[model samples]
Target: MIEIGHTPAKRLVTIRVSGKLTSKEYDTAVPEIEQAIEQSDGKLNAVVELDDMRGWDIAALWKDLKFDARHFDDFRRIAVVGASGGEKLSSKAAGALTSADVEFFLRDQVDKAEDWAAAD
Candidate 1:
C-alpha cells in the first residue's frame, strides 16, 4: 500500500509505502504527484518513507522507472527514510538517477527528513 500527503503550498510531498507495492498503487499515487509538480511549476520536494515495504512487483518497478525518468528534474530534494541497509543503498541508487539532492535517513530520523524536504 502507498499513502501520499501534500502540503497546501504544493512545495513538498510525503509518500509512505507499506507492504508490497503494485502497479495499482502507483497508478493512484503518481498522478497526484505529477499534479503537485504541475501546480508548483516544477519546484517540489519529496520525502519517501518505506515502512515494512517488502518490495515492488515487476509492473510497479516499471512504473517507478518511468516516473523517475519523466520527473528527473522535477524535485529539488528527495529524502528517503527507511530501516534497512538495502533501503539506504536504494536511496543512493536513486540519487544517481535524478538531479535532486537525495538523502537517506534512518527510520528514527524521519522528522529530520521531513525538515530537510520542507526547507527552502
Candidate 2:
C-alpha cells in the first residue's frame, strides 16, 4: 500500500509505503504528486517512509522509474525514513540521479527526518 500526504501549504509531502507496492498505487498517486509539485511552485520537499514496505511489483518498478525520470528536479530535498539497511543504501544510489538533496534516517528518527526535509 502507498499513501501520500501533503502539507497545508503543499510545499512538503509525506509518502508512506507499506506492505507491497503495485502499479495501481502509482496510477492513483502520480497525478496527486504532480499536483502537489505544482501547488508548491514546482519544487517540493518529501519524507518517504519505507519501514513497513515489503517490496514493489515489477510493473510498479517501471512506473516508479518513469516518475523519477520525469520529476528528478521537482523535489528540493528528500528524506527517506526507514529501518531497512538496504533501502538506505539504495536511496543513496538514487540520489546520484536526481537534483534533490537526499538523506536517510532510521524510522526512529522521523522527527529529525521531517525537520531536515522541511528546511529550505
Candidate 3:
C-alpha cells in the first residue's frame, strides 16, 4: 500500500509504503508525484518510506526508472526510508537510486531522513 502526503505549499511530496509494492502502487502514486513537482514549479522534495514494505514486483522496477527519467532534476532531493541490513530489498533500492539524487536511510532514521529532505 502507498499513501501520499503533500506539504502545505505543495513543494514536498512524501510517499509512505507498506507491504508489497506492485504496478498498482506505482499507478496510484506517480500522478501525485507529478502533480507535486508541477505545483512546486519543478522543485520538489520527495520522501519515500518503505519501512513496512515486503518487496516489489518486476514491472514496478520499470516504473521507478520512468520516474527517475522524468523527475531526476525536478525532484531535487529525495529521502529514502527503510534501506538497511543489506537485504535484497535494500540492495535493489540502492541500485535503483544510483541514477537519482536521493538520501538513503534506515527505517529507524526517520528524523535524519526528514532533516535531509528539508535541507537546502
Candidate 4:
C-alpha cells in the first residue's frame, strides 16, 4: 500500500510505502502529489518513508517512472527514510525519479529527514 500526506501548510508532501505497492495506489498518490506540487508552486519538498516496502508492481513501476519524468523539475528536495542500510539503494533509486537533492536516513533519523526536507 502507498499513502500520501502533507504538512499542515501543505508545502511538504509525505509518502509512506508499505507492503507491495500497485498502480492502483499510485493512481491515488500521483494526483495527490500533483495537487501538492501545484500548490507548492512547483517547488515542493518531500519525505518518502519506506516502511515494510516489498517492492512495486510492474504497472506501478511504469507509472512511477512516467510521473518522475513528467515532474522532475517540480521537486526541490526529497528525503527517503528507510529502516536499514539495505535500503540505501532504494533511497538512491527514489532519488533518480527527480532532479531534486535527495538524502537517505535510517528510521531513527526520520526527524532529521523531515527537518531537512521541510527547509527552504
lDDT of 4 by residue, 12-77 (tens): 999999999998988988998898888885589999999989888999999988998999888888
Mark the 10 consecutive residues where model 2 has the least summed lDDT. Answer: 1-10
Off by over 4 Å in 2: 8-10
Model 1 local distance difference test score: 0.91
List lDDT for all candidates, in order: 0.91, 0.89, 0.74, 0.86
Q: Candidate 1: misplaced stretches above 4 Å?
A: none
Q: Which pairs of residues have clashing backbones in candidate 2?
A: none
Clashing pairs in 4: none
Write the number of the candidate with greater TM-score, choosing between 1 and 4.
1
Per-residue lDDT of candidate 3, residues 5-88 (tens digit): 998363678889888889988898889878777788657877788766777898987898777766556766777787655543
Q: TM-score of each candidate? A: 0.95, 0.94, 0.78, 0.92
Per model, how many backbone clashes are there? 0, 0, 0, 0
Against the correct fold, how does model 2 do in TM-score? Answer: 0.94
State which candidate, 2 or 3, has the greater TM-score.
Answer: 2
Off by over 4 Å in 4: 8-10
